[model samples]
Target: MAQPRRRATPTKRDLLRADLRRSTPEELSHALQMLLDQSRLSRDERLHALASALVVEALAPYWVGDRTPNQAHDALCADDEELARVIEALAPMLLGHIEVREEARDAVATIEAMLGF
Candidate 1:
């Protein structure tokens, strides 16, 4: 008798893609429109958006109902010094998002490369 083969576990990316495939046409259209809008944003604006997304993910464990991701980003931006510090701290994590690592590039540059902008 042949031994049974085990199935490979699904990765987060695989699961996400599967879920996306099941989305309604309207939902897919809305998602596509949002991506298109993001692509149209200026470099600075797109950098801000990427930083906000990073902050949102990092802060999710501590996020409360009253504080939204945009609100959290706004509060962080209000303190320019702190914002710089936060960006510096988040810079190492940005490495995982991009394919190639360039020496001495800032977070904005890394994000631009990640986004292909």
Candidate 2:
């Protein structure tokens, strides 16, 4: 008799990291826009938190990657204006709904510091 092996489910962070890594720049912008729209329309605290976390995850690599936050931020702004615009548009909504969730706060703070807001 053979034993069956079970696969582990991915965590939310794992899923998010994968999504960010695999997304193209345009896809990333679209995802941010969708999250921003959800944040604007949804009153649910959990949904807001999730959206905020995703936005942060998308931007974190640029802001907190190998380069300095300022350097990454500068490069992003210079190289990808559309993506930068999407981030700028989403920042205030994320900041407004930031709650006790550490991921949400860190994400919002990363964008704010990156944008000099």
Candidate 3:
């Protein structure tokens, strides 16, 4: 009989969040510490939203392809204004296509409801 393949283990981030939901102090602290690493952002929600936006942006390369597409994101992070614009423009559309978590959905909404569009 053929057997099903085992799924990949959840990431540390996922484990951390799970621990948070369980009210485990160590896990909660780890999650907070992780967010603290990105303290430049005004809120964790904003960071969460940007993280969601980035996953959406990342998938663009598959559709954007190597057909003379912009290479800025590949070259350097935050050096691609056009990519940012395109990501912002296409975020809503991308949201429908992805199977993101509620947190990620909220993050996407955060980006959408920002000062601009």
TM-score of each: 0.28, 0.38, 0.21
- Across residues 28-86, which tens digit of lDDT does each residue of candidate 1 receive? 65554455353567765566566657666555544567987656555556655575468
**Model 2, span 81-101: residue lDDT tens:** 887777677776776655445
How would you order the candidates by TM-score, starting with the best? 2, 1, 3
CA lDDT, candidate 2, residue 14? 46
Candidates by lDDT, descending order? 2, 1, 3
Off by over 4 Å in 1: 1-38, 65-117
lDDT of each: 0.59, 0.65, 0.57
Query: Who wins the lDDT comparison?
Result: 2
Which should have the higher TM-score, number 1 or number 2?
Answer: 2
TM-score head-to-head 2 vs 3, winner? 2
lDDT of 1: 0.59
Candidate of highest TM-score: 2
Q: Give per-residue lDDT, candidate 3, residue 95.
A: 62
Q: List the residue pairs that clash in candidate 1.
A: none
> Which residue pairs overlap in candidate 2's backbone?
none
Q: What tens digits encode model 3's per-residue C-alpha lDDT throughout 1-117?
A: 999975444455665555456667776655655655545555644555666757555645543645333453444235555766656565565465354666788888899889566
